[model samples]
Target: MNQVFHRFVEGIVRETDSNQEEREDLYEELLSHLECSFKDYQKQGYSNEEAMRTVMTNFGDERKIGQQLQQAMYPYRREMMLGLSVASLLYAYGVYLSQLLIMGDAHILWLVVAVLSSTALLLLTVRPVSSLNRRLWMNSLLLIHILIFFYGLLLATDVYHPVSIGLTIIASLILLLAIVLVYRTTIYDFSSNRQRSAKDAKRLHFINITTGIFVVFVILFFLWAFLFFSAEMSPAVFIIFIPLVIWIVSYASQMHLLSRQKKKWAYSIAIIQTAIIICLIGLWLLGV
Candidate 1:
């Protein structure tokens, strides 16, 4: 294919969210059609450059066509983003109300998290799907926020206010729905004709980042316990740090694997690490 046709396909493919493999397939298919059309135009006695122009003109505007193709592939994308944005904002308000009513203090960190998440979701509604490098950031933030809410619920005392409890429950439910939306979009991304290694690499990277964030939060919690609650560094404390150490090591291994382009091994490590985390969280919830 000529440079004109190749560049045209490239333009369309850039507006798509398809992975490398799928993009190549699309490029080939579009190039074939353009070539066939050019030959037909040649039979009509048009010069080479004139034939190229005719083919391109008949194909329509590359950007507009690309955008349309994107919409066809992911029809409800804007709606879902908008819904999640509204839900996140509501969840943020609930968090603010609950903290004020229960702790009698502003939980600035969590409030910022909710608001930022909401803002990000809102912006995503306007942004093209292909514009974002990775969707991991939004999903990671939501997952962490959900866990924080769950932990708060677990640590609740009998002295909790009814209004606060009500707000927390409602907020948690809204956030859970938001999570469902996240899962749906993620599944959509994975369903595309992407390479397995490529998809796994993205997930592994997400695990690496999320686990590091969890480690920081755990350390801060421990520091707060020691300073404010007069807690000692007992065996129990060390026990809590055990999994964290393991997670840190796993993070290092994952980074090494990724650097080596051993994506499959990195993915395996990510799954095991995630399983361990889920098990630990289950035990904590069960009060074991």
Candidate 2:
């Protein structure tokens, strides 16, 4: 009976494909289940041979089970491969653009940053080790992507030129606005009923407030750092930073007010935001 049980376990081991640790864990689990079933049969007065036969019969199609286990273990493998492939292609094109924009010149620093950031992005997203890790990774990659792209854009335009810097600021603001709009709208979604929709909207208000404050702090820190690094710090940083502050504050404040059913101040902030954008556009045009 022990020999027969051992043979059945070996059959499963041959079928399973996993690392040593996973294989050992699976082996223990499968062995425990088989033992429980075999003991249950013994309690019914089955002989050893009869119990072994019943256990083996119930085990059923080890090959298929092993394949399913492998698939389950690697649920995100396909998605990771697809996303990483696309990300690589994008970075490749960015490299090409860098060379073309500067007439065969390249920004080695930004190129290195882009490479490292994309690699980290791929590794973190590949396995999703944990939910909190995924969220932190996503937030970090977003900041990395933005900051690197900003630097790359400046490099491509030849950062020594003020016009180039101004253009990068304008472009970054437009991009930031578009992205914030997307995040703001999408974060208040996916409800199956009106009650859930209302609840999600309420949650959206607080979340946007929290995210908005964090973003503002991040931008302020970036501005201070950039200024500290510059021997002769210019106003170009503020050209971008001011509008970003205004837009996010406006958007978040409006969302909060509307969520709390306060319309008057929301409209007031909306008007202020429009004025700020117009003033920034005027400054941008003057610089151009």
Q: Name the best candidate (by TM-score).
A: 1
Residue pairs in clash, model 2 = none
Off by over 4 Å in 2: 1-106, 133-140, 154-240, 286-288
lDDT of 1 by residue, 45-129 (tens): 9999899989999999999888787677668765666776676677566656666776786557756766776776676556546
- Candidate 1 error regions (>4 Å): 1-7, 47-50, 97-104, 129-132, 135-166, 181-188, 191-288
Error of 1 at 35 (Å): 3.6
* TM-score, predicted candidate 1 vs. hidden true structure: 0.60
Top candidate by lDDT: 1
Superposition error at 189 for model 1 (Å): 1.8
